[model samples]
Target: MHGYAHDKDNYAKRLRRIEGQVRGLARMIEEDKYCIDVLTQVSATTKALQAVALGLLDEHLKHCVSEALAEGGEQAEDKIREASDAIARLVKS
Candidate 1:
């Protein structure tokens, strides 16, 4: 997917919501919420973080990788290798 730049405001808003979720999780822990409930929230937070990571990776591939490929040199190969390694780590998490 070729990514174009998105509005900074929207991205900030998304991050803010994720921050709120983290704070809520902390509060839940402090309040001694149910163990299962806490785990569920933790799962949701993990998913949210994964979503953000994937989005950034997609953007990098769409713009940076594409440009590197167009340049047609060792840089392009390096970027591909780096992106692959990052994706592997991401998936393992």
Candidate 2:
């Protein structure tokens, strides 16, 4: 029913990889890895997450928002507003 549903498996796989990256980050901290190395990995992990977010946003725009806009009414307006709020949150993050 959702925009990302079609590719849900891919999304889940990516999230699982990100989860492993996070666990690795914790391990690095426990091992007292070098600051710069840890920071680099952190940046990598952050970028991976951002990539997933952007992908989902793209799917939302192409599927959900487009469908609502095609219908052309209150639902369209609501979707546009909701998408805008989501974008704002992502930008702030």
Top TM-score: which candidate number?
Answer: 2
The digit string of per-residue lDDT tens for model 1 on 37-75 reads 999999998998888788889888988888999998999
Query: Against the hidden true structure, what lDDT does model 2 obtain?
Result: 0.97
lDDT of each: 0.87, 0.97
Q: Report RMSD for candidate 1.
A: 2.6
Residue 77 shift from truth in candidate 2, angstroms: 0.6
Model 1's alpha-carbon lDDT is 0.87
Question: In candidate 2, where is summed lDDT lowest over 10 consecutive residues?
Answer: 81-90
Off by over 4 Å in 1: 1-7
The reply for model 2, stretches above 4 Å from the true place, is: none
lDDT for each residue of candidate 2 in 1-93, tens digit (9 for 90 to 100): 999999999999999999999999999999999999999999999999999999999999999999999999999999999999999999999
**Can you list the residue pairs that collide in candidate 1?**
none
Q: How badly does each model clash, as a count of residue pairs? A: 0, 0
